[model samples]
Target: MLLLNNHTMKSKIEKSTFIVKLTAVLVVLMISIISCNKELTDRKDFSNNTGGNVIDAQQQKVLYVIVDGARGESVFKSSTPNLSKMIKNGMFTINAVSDENGLSATSWADMLTGVDKTKHKVISEDFSNNKLTDYPMFFKRVKDNTSLRTAAFSISPALSTKLVTHADVNTSLPNDEAVKTATLAELANNNAAVVLAEFQGVDKAGAQYGYDASVPQYAAAITNIDTYIGELNTAIKARPNFSKENWLIVIASNKGGDYPVIPALMDQTLYSKPLLNGFVILYNPNFKSTIYNKPANLNSLPYLGSYGKLNGDTIASVDAAKSNLYNFGTTGEYTVEFKLKVQSFGTLNAPIFFKTSSPANAATGWWIIHNGSNGTWRLGGLASAAISTPTTKAMEVNQWYNIGFKIYFVGTVRYVQLYQDGDPIGSPTVITGRTVNNSEPLVAGYRSGFGNSATQFITDIRIFNAAVPDAVIKDFACQVLLDSRHPNYNNLIGYWPALDGAGTLIKDQSKSKNDFVFQKSTQWLSFEDYDNKFCIKPTPELYKIVPRGIDIPRFILGWLNINATGFNLDGKVWTPIYTNILK
Candidate 1:
């Protein structure tokens, strides 16, 4: 009986061991199946299917609209239903600012060329020199792509000559009615890669009649423009080709005009009111969050990032750095902050200061900041160190820092704070009894003195109309330290007026001097018959005939040489170079 019981126990133990081994095998098989399924799903989503039709590159198109003089503030007040709807549905830049030059021709030229006026050498309406004419105009660079059609219509006479002379297609009609017709016709063609439209009657009227008299005309023009813009939007929506993956439309204003003057003048000189110039708005439907993930090796040095529009031909690093300097307005409180990554601490004790360009008094509208004599940050309105802290902590190299200020009621201010890696430095110090003056341009990246420079990586820099809440400020600092995205960062780079097929930077070569040359060429000469004697002259006027034997640059020639490799517009990359530049 004892032997029988031992055998039964042994058999049960073996069965239990077998059951445990089987369970382990099943678990491993389930995990393997899940892992394979995940890999397959990812491949299916991104991989190009062999049976699907490949999209031809020539079918891509972009619409770019530049309103000659529209203020960021006035966009909401202007009763532009179409623009407002687009802004809400797509993307809108609330604090979009333009560069220094307020002139339409200069600003538009910068927009089209992406090169500074100094490079393009086209500054104002009176500019007649064709020295830079041969440089490939923006459209000329992409015109050869057979699938890519290009056209531009401008209501401003200031732009008419330049457009006809430089653009790939001169489609400007005499009046607003003609502009609508041409714009619609281009839309119907379905082959165009880019279409640029400019409206300037309001600007002309504003310049002629005073701001008040021109208000109605401006309002009327905006209404008409809104109607047409809506029509275009509707037409594009109706087309099968108009998908998020295929088409993009950009709407923006070249600059803002100044009217209803406000006492507060912060960087108003760039586009002062009664003429407020530098307001620009952008809308892109295809934008994704990844666009702001600062591209690898994107130089963070001042002026190395996207250079804003500024005066002068060649904008040096200093000029680029100086572009962000702004002043406090007369009435409201203003705040400015810089997100910088420092490398090493130098002998410079006072790394930051604020002061006016001139002595702070009742009248001047400019102010500046710099290092103070007492080893502290100084406020422009106050004589002594407004915020004092020991400079004992060694500055960490390649780490982000935040320099912020809160200015109350013109010059009556609170305190400024400096944070290194999200922690406030030492203590919060205060300043008392100072008048707000706007005599000097506000500056950063150096001491209060002229040209006290520093090499730092700056990003997500911002200026606010109201004092930033401490909680929001802390979150901002934390995000910067963690390398997280902020609303303002999106406002800075992602909300561009236009974008390429990849939904990255604006694809229009016009924004950069990609295909155009700014040098003199016979092809750019304007001809006139003086008493039946035809004479060619270098002028801003348009030429009807293409000049023969014009010397094309090596880069352009290289593009032309490769035009036969199924790479030219006809094969895939629809562009206008053959018709506009090569001709």
Candidate 2:
């Protein structure tokens, strides 16, 4: 669905460009409005400007809870009524991320230190050689700036011992129940301005069983934490100064466990890693519901299809009748293109794609082949002919490359052009007198004697009757799948994606209906096209809106109306709700 046709895609880009320009102007106006009203009263009015509740910074308290290994998808699937209520009353997102490293030590530091693993150096469980002193926990920031009472409760002793520095009351308990009991006790008796707690039951359950909601133990553990959350919320509400206090309840996961997500939930990027998947909720009575959902990207269709890894043992071919139009005779003009990733340099003159009875230079045929001399490809035909030429540049192994060639006639003069990634490889070589037409079927992957030692991957075969222009080839070189954007769309006589996933017949998408049939067992391969160089930008809808653990400290600072710029924190405020509150 993300692969819109050329016209639709162009229209979308134009509209998106205008909206971005408009958003830029609006952002300037919003900044001006914020700067003009720097007072707390004016900021409070600004919070309610969009009809949200009036929130006083002085009365704000935070109860930030971190649950380990709670996959956001699993949490969404589980029955957590308490969390659902908070989601309705908060700025929340199921598509939030943790530190990419996905280690407890790393994400814990990310949540507490307001920085990534690269800055904090807490990449392992032992907390060895960390830079915690330079970027100490947020509790230290609060202690240095204000006299506010801060408390930290955790089931992991290392968190209380290693990371929870400068908290007025820091305690490590044995289990989730003990942690919850101590947190409930603190809320009932003490008036802590910030209370941070960590629970480990979900992570423990995930480690024992699995991280999916289908696992009874994992689902039960999540519901159990929800129960504890319910109890904690009850205690907070029962406080004597409840009506006067404005509380910000923050619930989040340090990281997700190692489990494959369902296809429906897969983002098909680095963000789709199970360990990087987590959730964040910044709940307050005054805030309006704002949820950041997963955005659709250009990878929505995901170039997921069958690829061929020819290791000298497999060959695919089209019948001569079906492949006759593909042969560039003395008079005809044609183009051939395909994607290739060389696993290793093959035998001297390995036939990658050819249309002939023999692959010898003296044979009356043409081939797109690997030249063992310089680890590059060359055009092969009758010996000492213009149709035989080697590419100037060598191709690297294990990297995807778009390889193409076109033969056309300008007046009575004929020329053969080579292309690598859609750019002409040197200048065109004249082959006016060379005749490469053959009666043999068009063959790929293997031919007698020339392909036995070859190893490479091949897919997305395209054959056009018209000699395509250089501009059009370069424009669609990185395209994973062809569409109407191609100027020679109607001229394609053969188009085999070679991605049937499980079949001997490589389906043809072109109007000519010429399909390539495998002569032997095809070595089908699977890969993700997430790293396509063509459409590299992520979809704009939720680009930077998804929250992260590093943002927790900045969120706290913003809620408390504290200036975070002086702290040199490496995080942004979690939501736009706190934008006007930041000094």
Candidate 3:
């Protein structure tokens, strides 16, 4: 009976194992089928819009479409079969930016003249003080080189009247439909070398509703324009000589629309600004697919946590055996540095970091305070509230800054100097009769009646036992992570990265092990590592290299094999593919 039972159990176990293996195989097969279906769907879509394979002997023609106020990300997210087809077949970038000036005329001038707003000066909608005559429209450049006819049809009358110079046929229409009709007719009958059609309905829809894909009207408007684009493609294909023509179809948006503040888009970089976002698609059947993404932000710090507003919120050091190592006496030289972001500057002096529990006039502690009235910070000693001169550059609100102070002596003359980023904020001041040594734990923030709702963020607090050299201070002030490369790495008495994603205690990575204990619950915040160097907006020079509205003219000129050498255009050509096509 026992032998029979054992044989039966082994058989049951084998059957169970076989069932489990079968289930696993079925799940993998289902996943593989789903993935293959998606790939096949994509391939089918691409095949339907191939526009025929490229022919080496085909004539090169240009068709550029401009959709006003269409945010790049929104357009990418929208369901547009026509745009998607082109995107899969050619070079594209949803991360393209508009003009830094953020005006329609500024963008138009950049697109037509191959230069930035600083050169063309078309800063407003009215086109009051523009230097377009010096850097005339690309149509004029094309006309000067070759006798090829160029035409432009714009929904905005101002574009035709003020900006569309040197065109063989410049027609100003009232609506997108009319502009599309005119452009289609021009493409059908005329042998135009370059054709430009500007549609304004997208911008109008965005202005009324919103600029996001979630907004029905905005998405519908983009889709409607996508249908018009499909019709235009059909017209181009219907041309009698279409089989012998190589069309470079370019589609882009002038700028993105402004909307309510979105927390997700609040990355501390120019790319975070909605008004600066746009799209660019340079399509040709012969071109290989090349999609550009947002450039990697080289100089950015990861935002980890938010303890609270600086009004009364404080993160103090725990009472450890080596807590007194941070106390810098009048005779002892030391450096205290941290990253700060002030939300608002109130009337009262903001005490960023101090060693004393009660920091007052003639107190035996040193402190760094920001004067709200003059927009400058000063190093304070015990005898007086301020020791060093006020910084020339006032600290701006809602911006990340690396600020600290160094206390050193010049042959018995103890001096305190305030530093911003890696450079000195103001001239050093002589410290006369002040002792910064105290028994109280080193405090990061304190209650100064800074005003209701006046808050600040503090992190990456580093306190050194010795005064670091100026070069060393400058080198590591903007550094996000603490490493052994620092010359004063061994002199670090207290170092709190404050990046512990959770918990009330901020662990100190230094050898002293003096941790910071938050008084209240940890209020943590997160951020994408954005380039703080170009926090708000990139300079026009930086925008020149990226895919922007300004590059459209230069790109067109390159496609036409025209040498824009002496044009002195600020915009550079984005030659991703077809390098041999450009002169």
Instruction: Report the alpha-carbon TM-score of model 3 versus the true structure.
Output: 0.55
True-structure RMSD for candidate 2:
20.0
TM-score of 2: 0.55
Model 2 Cα lDDT, one tens digit per residue, 226-249 = 999989899899998887777888
Clashes of each: 57, 1, 0
**Is candidate 1 or 3 superior in TM-score?**
3
Q: Across residues 44-159, which tens digit of lDDT does each residue of candidate 1 receive?
A: 11111222222333234567767666655555556678876665434344233343445666556656544445566666656456324544344654554343556788777657
- The segments of candidate 2 whose C-alpha lies over 4 angstroms from its true place after superposition are 1-54, 262-267, 298-543, 576-583
Q: Is candidate 2 or candidate 3 better by lDDT?
A: 2
Instruction: Please give the lDDT score at residue 501 for candidate 3.
Output: 59
Residue-level lDDT for 73 in candidate 1: 51
Instruction: Output the better candidate (1/2) by lDDT.
Output: 2
True-structure RMSD, every candidate: 21.0, 20.0, 15.8
